[model samples]
Target: MEETDHPQYCGIGIRGVAIGIDSFVWIALLFVAIFITAAFTGQLETGSPGLNAELSGAPASMALGLWFVLALGYHTVFEWRFGKTIGKALVNIRVTSEDGSSLTFTSSLIRNAMRFVDWLPALYLIGIVGIAVSGQRKRLGDRVAGTAVVGS
Candidate 1:
């Protein structure tokens, strides 16, 4: 890790507002998925067709999966290309290592891929505790990847 005026600081500026932006974006994606499904397949009635029900679940799962992948893609690509995600861009923050170096692709993948682990045991139990207790607001993946989120 590199030393700076704020040696122990987390990255550029991924703060509460970034969290809010992430929530809004994800919720909008979810709702849009729902709306699109309904628009093409018909209303979600109690006694909907069985085939429709099955297709609905598959499509819903696909939509969620797509969102998951895209979110990672956005973060990885934007961060590497522009040093920010959409939310991070809006907030003027960037992610880096403790030494102020850009995160490698593998490192970014490890961090984002382990998001499932941090979200383990339901309700983000592990992640919540980790971030809360961590001095730099690092969750498991961040620690493992030896990276930090900071203001740019």
Candidate 2:
């Protein structure tokens, strides 16, 4: 019997879990950064007026902006250099080209950049549907980038 060349694609459940883990990792890093900055500025003490003011008047927009940059950097760098994020590694999955080759920087950037589209309508419903319908189990970003997630 001849062996097949087809890749074993990753399903949405595992992908969703991996994303959840990645989200937690990013959130933890953000919290650590905030605490470190607060400590450096001598605002770590709860009773300190500076700390109270900082917390009370904190700009959520700034945090959201930082999060956007962090996520873009994290996903792009990992997929470009390693073909897998920490979450994907833990899940034993990786992203690769449609031809089953290593991901290129351009492909990684395209996929990660289109994450906004995948997140449309909340909770990645569009991406979920796309992956389900795609024979190779590709999300919008993956399809646009000519990439797919598969078992490592």
Per-candidate Cα lDDT values, in order, are 0.67, 0.83
| Cα error of candidate 1 at position 66, Å | 1.7
Steric collisions counted per model:
7, 0
Local accuracy of candidate 1 as per-residue lDDT tens digits, 16-40: 5665576677776666555556545
Name the best candidate (by lDDT): 2
Residue 67 of candidate 2: its Cα lDDT?
62
Candidate 2 lDDT score relative to the true structure: 0.83
* Error of model 2, residue 28, in angstroms: 1.9
Residue 123 lDDT in model 2?
Answer: 91
Q: Write the per-residue lDDT of candidate 2 for residues 54-134, one digit (tens) a residue.
A: 432344445455667777889999999999999999999899998888899999999999899999999999899998998
Cand. 2 TM to true fold: 0.81
lDDT of 1 at 114: 71
